[model samples]
Target: MKQTTMNRTQRTVCTVLAAAALAAGLSACAPLIVGGAVVGGVMAVDRRTAGTQIEDEGIELRAANRIRETFGDRVHVNVTSYNRQALLTGEVPNAQERQAVEQLVSQVENVRSVVNDLTITTFSSTLSQRSNDTFITGKVRASLVDAQDISANSFKVVTERNVVYLMGRVSQREANRATEIARGVSGVSKVVRVFEIVSEEELRRIAPQPAPVTTDDTKPSGG
Candidate 1:
């Protein structure tokens, strides 16, 4: 019994440590671009194809640049694109600016649709508030990782003003499980699921295939 208890304790400690390490790495909440591919460790598990991933990144970059050039410091907006679906978050000064922001993002090339979650506030979120949002996002991500039943990398988490937006190409079961996990996180006030629900068979169909092994018998002879 003592040995069993000790093993249980050790497992708990390892789980905690692993979750912490993953959270620290993901706390940045920004995807890295390497050789035009999304390289945040999610590429392999992400349901989106390589081409779709690149298009999503392009959509995000182009939309953000357009917003900055048009609105300057007058608006504070965050653009997160996944599977060509762009989600707009943060604060805008007024109704007109809010509508304009959505319109501008819609015009970006290759954007399939836009989900505008911008708040019409007089001032943008303070740095401290944004930091808190990032922390909440990390916590939610860690919780998802700890769940163990779902692939955490399949979801893209974005938080603004305590609201968490989850985006991914997932089945309904995965989406529901992810949403529940996100909502359980302490700092998350709301969980918004922006998922493209696909069938389980469809998910398997789109899954990446392994390269065929080359055997000595199959080796090509030099001419």
Candidate 2:
């Protein structure tokens, strides 16, 4: 009977020891999993922030201007961010309405800036330029995408009167490269850079691409 009791105690102790070892192993792995989750969350937030930073501010200013032009000083206009860039679409009632919207947006903080592209046409049509505006936007966006030197996701582009407005957080080098690319596009007559550099990634992405080389066979001999 004593021998039986000893074996039972030994089994219980071994079970407890095994459980403790398993717990320790899990404890060690928990941090790595947790660390990965934290890093992923941060990256997602940054991308969201970058995406909305210019666009929200842009949409807000555009909405405010539309309201002010449509409702006059009756409505209060406020702008809350910069990652957003605004393109004034549709028709304004008069010249006063156009200027009023511009002035209001100018005063709004975090407004990368405003483009008063509103046409002073008759409201008879109520034509939505959203699609047209989107087409121009896609053009500039594709141009930016083709050139790998800039973080295409980091920019908010708006086009007005063939002028391209670039808004985002980027290094000076990135901003310059962006300007150059926009200027080179066929429809772009001018480019406005409204940018702020926030990190080193901006600097790294803006380095120019190496030029292509040609062999002697491909090039004519110099006279």
Candidate 3:
């Protein structure tokens, strides 16, 4: 999938929702029908890591007052992560508000990097941030699909703002390799490692069944 100027992530999600409504109008097998997608074809998940959860809590804690004051108790920003990278996604009213969110988040400890995916709700760049985020996730999935050493199916990509969080059961080396690809993508601001290192024994248990095909996919396309 290609990234559009309007936040493709949000658009894609909305597209799925719209397609779902349309599919319901046309189909009798509602349960078997997936909106805008097929389950067996390819799956992209927002697989969050333990570190990402911690980072999210920390960010929320840090910005609780500002966000509440800005939105008047309606928490609009969506926070998610994988491998310690924190992603902030949602609409903010203005550029000042967006910057405020980023400034506050940068103060959090243990954060390797921040990808500011917050879009100003102005007409011009309203969807730019969102499309960038979706592109980041797609690129990461694509990398995993193309990498020979990585198990693309085991990892998940989560975006908060423009940051990419990777969650997977990978060895340290594999995780490092995945992070490298994520960091190398265009438009990626920073890559945060939020993975739980898997030992050889765990790998054997987690990947007992073999896959018929292979993909060189890695972590998030852009962080």
Instruction: Output the number of the lDDT-best candidate.
Output: 1
Which candidate number has the best TM-score? Answer: 1
TM-scores for candidates 1 onward, in order: 0.81, 0.47, 0.46
Give stretches of model 3 more than 4 Å off.
Answer: 1-74, 79-125, 210-223
Kindly list the per-residue Cα lDDT of model 3 for residues 1-223, writing each as its tens digit.
Answer: 3556557677656545433433232245433322122343433222343345456557655555456665663335654444445566666778777777776656666555555676566443336666777767776666665566765655666544567777665788878888888888776787766677878776656443433677769756876
TM-score of 1: 0.81
Residues 1-223 of candidate 2: C-alpha lDDT, one tens digit per residue? 9999999788766444433332232254332211112321221112334345446646675666656666664332333344444445445567886687667666654555665556675442212444444456566666665565665645667655455677666767778888887788775667867566656774445433334776678677788
Question: Which ranges of candidate 1 are over 4 A from the true structure?
Answer: 1-44, 210-223
- Candidates 1 and 3: which is better by TM-score? 1
Q: Of the candidates numbered 2 and 3, which has the greater TM-score value?
A: 2
Each candidate's clash count: 0, 8, 29
lDDT for each residue of candidate 1 in 1-223, tens digit (9 for 90 to 100): 9999999898777556545544553346644433223355433366787788789889999999999999999999999999999999999989999999999999999999999999999889999999999889878876776677887767788999999999998999999999989888898889898999999999889766654777798778998
lDDT, each prediction: 0.83, 0.55, 0.58
Error of 3 at 76 (Å): 2.9
Clashing pairs in 2: 53-83, 53-84, 54-83, 54-84, 54-85, 55-83, 55-84, 58-85
